[model samples]
Target: MTTLTRARTGPFAADYAALKAAAWLTPARERAWERLQEAASPSERRGNERWKYTDVRPLTSVPYRLAHAGALPGLAEVKKIAPWDDAWTTLTFVDGHFAPALSTEPTGRVAAGRLATATASVQSLLEARLAKVQAIDEEYFTLLNTAFLSDGAYVHVPDNAVEERAVHLLFIASPATSPRVAHPRTLVIAGKNSQSKFVESYVSLADSDQHFSNAVTEFFLDDGAQVEHYRILAENEKSHHIGNTRVHHMANSRFNSISFAIGPAIGRNDHHALIDGPGAETNLSGLYMTTNGQHMDNNISVNHEKPHGTSRQYYKGILAGKSRAVFSGIVVVKPGADKTFADQKDLNLLLSPGAEVDTKPSLEIFADDVKCFHGATAGHVDLDTLYYMRSRGIGLEAATQMLIRGFAAEVVERIKLPALARYVEGVTEKMLPEFRLEVPK
Candidate 1:
């Protein structure tokens, strides 16, 4: 593994000593901490090529104390924020500590709990596959999360098992006296010929609270496995949110992911996938809505390491006020990976004059017999559409909101979880009023 010697030792380093002593440190975790300590800081902060558009300096500079054991005093606040109305089994974590008080027991063909409570069989599965998809040298935030990794959702489905309801993992950040940070690490394993769905949500108790959330999740799909994953980011507007999700696909497996970024003053969500075997298929989709002084960035990359693999990426963003948004999509086809098919597209709707978006869609193809394409677009709502709606007795605000929602619906509709999809649509509708229709002159 490569190391970054120039990486700045940030706030995480300050709490490293206290954090390691409290948790039952394993050799793997110790190695990860060393990697983070040695790795260079986020290159994007230095105005580097990968993170040039989105500025995260303000977030990285804050000194946030890491959350420890018994952080959640009660479950009253968590129940209100987490979606527990349905029958889905929920594994709740408060301030990165698994809260059994607010979670439901896994009762089906699935095993779900904190890593500590994992059965021997489940532990074996996790030990064999936990960090295989995400490398420690790739990103600063990823390495940071792995170093402090303690209790998080660990889910496993046996071969040929099919789950009826989606498993929900809720990571709720409570108000802290001072600035605080939480690293929520989740590992999901789908056995061969198995199928399941998962919904992972990050939310704050109130909008006034200020905190930072650094989360990382990994998904392993064996041959003939199918998994649908949803990541919902609804943190407080005063908080900073950074998350990384890595997925590995085996032969004849399918993985679909939908990420919604609707909160946080400064947010960055990354979705990366590695197609390790032939006949694997993946669909990566995202929706980001930012308003006021918010800044949101969505980064996605899909690597095809085997022949006959297919992947697609679709990301859309809505920006209002002086908010800034970024969409970077990179698809790489390795040499001799013939018969690979990939497509990438990004669309942005700017609702204010000061709103900005930087989009980059690139495809690297080393094989001649591959079909790859990428495209991006950023602009305001169509004046003609607004005019037509006004002529039909619809008000300007309503008209603009409709158009913006329509743009985001394209991606939201693809989510396989019905309840989650509906909830997201409702949230998007409520967010529409934040933007106004200014007919372009």
Candidate 2:
């Protein structure tokens, strides 16, 4: 196995070289990196399937510098941005390195800590399920993360253990320097009959300082376990974010994921969920709000590999200014996965004439007995509705804002945690101003 010991010194060296130098690189990851180095740069045109709508030139233009391990965020500053209101445990990371003094150990049935400092027992558990949930071959960034993963959070909920408060993992990206990159990896394991909720948020300190956050989150749920995972990406507008989340559900298990992307100059999120056992259920929802010159993309897939599994996915985007948005969703039912139920929908509301949105929802089923459906819609807010609201004593801007809020209410209400739901509402309210929606007094 080839291990990465230090940051690369040259400008010509690929980003993978820096990654390889930052962490322990297994033989598999090394080989994957080699392939990435040889692969040709993707074309910027809209003909390519993966890069159909979003342009990749900005990401490929600059070679990102590795975030210095010495400039991690302070605990006092991180606490200010913590989004949830739970007495639950907390794990803090600065520039992708774990800060032990800033984080809280798990209480009762929950176990959370830094992966680099985890004991042999915890390491064994992680080793058993790390690469089992999702494949990292397709995307170069994921392969880079696998090749150079060093310090991040590790959480494990034992069998039948249920926590009253949600566990929070706040990843703080404070770049003391410019044009830096950090890869934060989180592994969450929910044991059989266990229940837990985890909230992961990414925030940056400065808007002009260019930073890249490439994060990967893996969730493994044992038989009959239930897990609700929420991810919020609200970084500076000048930053770039590339994130991938993989979820695996076992027999009779349930997994729910809600991801909100409200910031970043350019962001691409890939979500994958696998129903590996019978009677498993999965619910995936996402919301992306983009304004100005920002660009955001979301690609997701759900695989029903076993019989009698249920899956639902819905994604919505509100695009304003000249910003661009893309959403691609796919649901696949394999053979013998009979009686499986799957549905997917993607909707986009273009708030500006120049704003653009590209949405595609697909269903691929090999089983004849399965019920699967997919749909996509893109349009502007209803002028008639806005006019009606304005005539009923509401200002034009406030009326338009009310309609947009109502459009997102379905997905926001689907959030099971009351406190978290309200927090998300507040974030949505803050986003209205960017979309030119007036705040009603």
lDDT of 2 by residue, 93-126 (tens): 8788777666776788898888777788787788
lDDT of each: 0.82, 0.79
The alpha-carbon root-mean-square deviation between model 2 and the true structure, to one decimal in Å, is 4.8
The ten-residue window of minimal lDDT in model 2 covers 1-10
Best by the lDDT measure: 1
Off by over 4 Å in 1: 1-5, 20-25, 43-47, 69-80, 438-441
Model 1 steric clash pairs: 7-40, 7-41
TM-score of each: 0.94, 0.90
Q: Give the distance in Å from residue 1's predicted Cα in candidate 1 to where it truly belongs.
A: 18
Cα displacement (angstroms), candidate 2, residue 221, comes to 1.4
- Root-mean-square deviation of each candidate, in angstroms? 2.4, 4.8
